[model samples]
Target chain A: MRFAEAWRVALDALRANRMRSALTMLGVIIGVASVVVLVAIGTGAKREVERQVEGLGSNLLVVVPGRIDIGSAPAVSRLDLADVDAVSRVVGDPSRVAVTVASGETVRAGRRSDFTTVQGVLETTPAVFTRRLGRGSYLTASDVDTSRRVAVLGAAVAGALFGDRDPIGQQVSIAGVRFRVIGVFAPLGQSLGVDRDDEVHIPVTAAHRLYGTQRIDGIAVKAPDRERIDDLGARIVAELTRRHPDTEFSAVTQQQILGVLGDILGVLTGVLAAIAGISLLVGGVGVSNIMLVSVRERTREIGLRKAVGARPRDIGLQFLLEAVLLTSIGGVTGMALGVGAALTADALSPVPAAITWWSLALAFGVSAAVGIVFGVVPAQRAGRLDPVVALRAE
Target chain B: MATPAIEAVDVSRTYQLDGVSVPALRGVTLTVAAGDYVAVIGPSGSGKSTLMHLLGGLDRPTGGRLVLGGREVGSLTPPELATLRNETIGFVFQAFHLLPRTSAVDNVALPLVYRGIGARQRRERAAAVLGRVGLGHRLHHRPNQLSGGEQQRVAIARALVTDPTVLLADEPTGNLDTVNGQAVLALLEELNTESGVALVMVTHDNEVAARARRRITMRDGVVVADSAADDPPADSAAVPDGPAAGGDADPTAGDGTERAEAAR
Candidate 1:
């Protein structure tokens, strides 16, 4: 028999039991939709992390005072201004290196006291990173050399301490010491779960006297180009280790950080998609059960058809086609629902979501496969029935 | 004469029922020629239904040679036999067996679906046959919408739509009232006379059997009498309750010609 004719017969059978068909398809719909929505959320989170990392600087590298490998404990701060100079000599560019030493402290400007992160940084902070000034001027090399008490207020810190008033050149006290605000940093929201706009920046020498710490927290450096980042990292790590001698130091490039984060998110997405697929498997089982019931209910009809002229293969194909149709329709509906949910999630929720074309295709393909895998037994049973005995059935 | 539509030579069918062998047909011989009108009459479990099943190719004989449409029944595969049935035979069962929720024309057009015929031609042929059965006005009616007599006529149309050489009817009017039964029987006789298609019927109604040109009576898996040549035995038709309604006949001792003459 023609495939088209078999399809028509299958469609007719499904139409004869509209409620049962729809209920059977519901399983597959939910399975496919869950896979789509879950995968989109994972992919969206991964992309968001990548955007934040790239925003900092593409060719940037960081050197910290520890052997920053798996299971290694963080060490005491062994990096100081001398280590910064040593890194500058190896980089052959002074403005390409910046160092920061941060601790939480209260700041008071005309009795508006706010407790926030206060970082001791060099004049090269703006040149080494993507941070920008909103008003006034950034610190100069002469300010650090003279141990000048100048501060660059973070967006949030300035808003809290001055309340929208221009704070540049205003006097503020940190740890009982007075300092003049040199600039205000632009507004930057949270990245990697850290609040970027909730801190203060000041010349490195002044913060050493206020916090009474000789060692810096970490050093940031920008390579001349993408290709030389690894080479620059190796040289800086060797130079810093040589200077400290007794302590271990590590230098990491931007690609290494993004790669590790990507692997974790990728696995998470796969796991979620697989969990959703279990529901699809259950849906396929429902289809198989219904087909078996239909065969039993129509035994006399099968015998009649066989008595007239239908072959066993014809009967089997008709039943198999019915099952495939059930799941395929369910799969399509589920995919649409998933995409719609993903879009809705992206618009209304903080949880990021992005639909990948391949996820939709994979979900659809798996649902069809589930139909064929689960449908085989019932179709074969229908085909193997004895016409004589079938005709006797009520 | 032309090749007989079906010829069974000492064919037997033994069924296995839960580790016990139950013989349904034990070495029964029969022949049905082209355009012949034959009726099979017997009590329940007398092998009349078994003989019908074997003759129609819905089953195969366990022993002996049975030829249908010029092909040995034992030699053809299941698919090949199905195709042979489509080309050479049509069946009208007691239950009518019209697909529910489907119109009469489509039910009649089903057999042709296996013949690779286009849908339009199939419906047209089915409509023409329905017209011959006097059911052309009810072409679009479902089985539930038609009376028992009209349903039987629709079934007859379905059997005739393929233009088969032999039409097999198993208790064709068993489910109908007397009036509808007579009407369906009259329609079958008219089709047989006008078209020259061989007609083979299995019925328990002695009056129905009397209307046929020939009759074969079976008992205990064997043919006890055959009026294929002359006439039914004198005693066989006299029992209004039906010959063999007694339901017990010698299973191992019966020759077709001798027993028929002995009864006379």
Candidate 2:
């Protein structure tokens, strides 16, 4: 039989039961939409993490002091300035090593004093961490060499201290000790949903001597290149292991952290997406059930067509085409709704959702497959019907 | 010496219901030459419809050597039989089974579609045939929009569109009024005379049977009479008395030899 005639018959059948066809398609729509939205959310969160990690530069490594023994239990490690120098000697890269000591204290600019996080860092911290200056100039090597009491304010700190005025070459007091603001750092938007432009930067020696603290809290090291990050991280771990055998130090490369985060998100997205995919199975079953009912209802129409000279294959193809068309239309609509949801969620939240064309193609392809898989039984029934009996049926 | 247009040898059909075989047609044999108009008349249980279904190749005979258009029908596959039915035989039913939602033209074009004809040519051919059957004015009207007689005419138009050698109709006028029935019969007569396509109609009306050049009367799964009338039954029948004379006002009611007497 002609394909056009078969399609005409199928379209007529669809028009005959428009409401039933639409409701059957709704199942597929919900299934497709669920998968799209779920995958988008997971991928969006992952992309946000990647952006943050990349912002920290690909060659960076973070060293956080692990558990240490106290009176009765393990206490946090008491990492010090000596450990930073020892780490630097073993690594043999002066530009890469930087020690940071931080404290929460009130800083006064003129008459206003605000409670903000104050960090004591080496002169090379900006270079090591890839931090850029938005105004004036950054700390020079002479500043850290002479243990100068100079400070640099972050974008948020400068705004809070001077409002619309420039804070370069201005004096700000930390813990009642005045320090010159040499520069203001550029604004870094939220990283993991926390504003990073709100802290104060100062030389490490000034922070320890002024606050009467003897310990350094953290050290950030930069490798020469992305390929050396893991090797450098291993070398630093070996040095730290030899220097402080009893102290537990955890050295994590940025790539390792990124991988771990990606793995966790992958598992989460996979599970959510798998559960969402079950709806498609239910939708497929829904299609088969509706097709079965349709075949029963149109038994005579099929018989008449066959009697008038329709081939069994023609009847089969007609029913199969109807099912495929229904699911495909539903899939397209569901994909549209899914993309809209992803875009709206991205617009309103911090997650960066990117809808790709491949995802939409996948949705439609699955929908068409679902149609064929489910349409088989009903199409076979319609094709195999005896014209004599079918024509006699009520 | 030419082969008959339709042939059946010792054809028998049986139905199995609740594990019991109920015989419908037993050891029946018939033949019709091309261009002949014949009728098979019997009571409801005499298996005329079963014979018609078998003759049209809609169903296979349970036991028979059947041949149509010089091919052994019993050996043909389902698809081959369907092709033969489409090319060589056309059927008209009592119910006028046109697809409910389609136009009359579309219903007539359905047979051509099954023949793998293109859309444009099929539509044109369908319109042409509808015009031949005097349904050109109702080309786009659906079955519900047409009168009973008009719908049957459309059904007849559909049957003739393929130009089959034999037209197998089962009670073509069973659902129409007397006047509409006569009109349909007259149309069939005219078609047979003009086109010279063999016409085989199943009916219980003696008056309708009288119009055919040949008649076969069946009783209890067997052909009791097969005759060619020099003077048709209507011209000779005026006395209405008993079952032996085949004179029941209800033509379907007849005795054992009534079919033979009526044929003579």
Summarize candidate 2's per-residue lDDT along B1-264 as a digit string, tens digits. 356779999999999999999999999887777777888999999989889888888778889888887888888877787788888888898888888989999999889988998888888999998887777889999999998888988898888989988998889999987666766776776677668688999999998887776789989999988874334563234312322222332332122124334445
lDDT by residue (tens digit), candidate 1, B1-264:
789898999999999999999999999888887777789999999999999988888999999999988999988787887888888888989999889999999999999988878889989999998887877788999999998878988898999988888999999989987656766776676666667687899999998898776789999999998896455454123212212211122211122223333434
The list of candidate 2 runs beyond 4 A from truth reads A63-83, A100-121, A132-189, A193-218, A238-253, A348-351, B16-22, B218-264
- Chain A TM-score by candidate, in order: 0.93, 0.82
Number of the top candidate by TM-score?
A: 1
- Residue A120's lDDT in candidate 2: 85
lDDT of 1 by residue, A12-101 (tens): 999999999999999889998998999999999999999999988769999998877656777889788888889999999999999999
Worst 10 residues of 1 chain B by lDDT: B245-254
TM per candidate comes to 0.88, 0.79
Specify the highest-DockQ model's number: 1
Q: Number of the top candidate by lDDT?
A: 1
Query: Least accurate stretch of 10 residues (summed lDDT) in model 2 chain A?
Result: A67-76
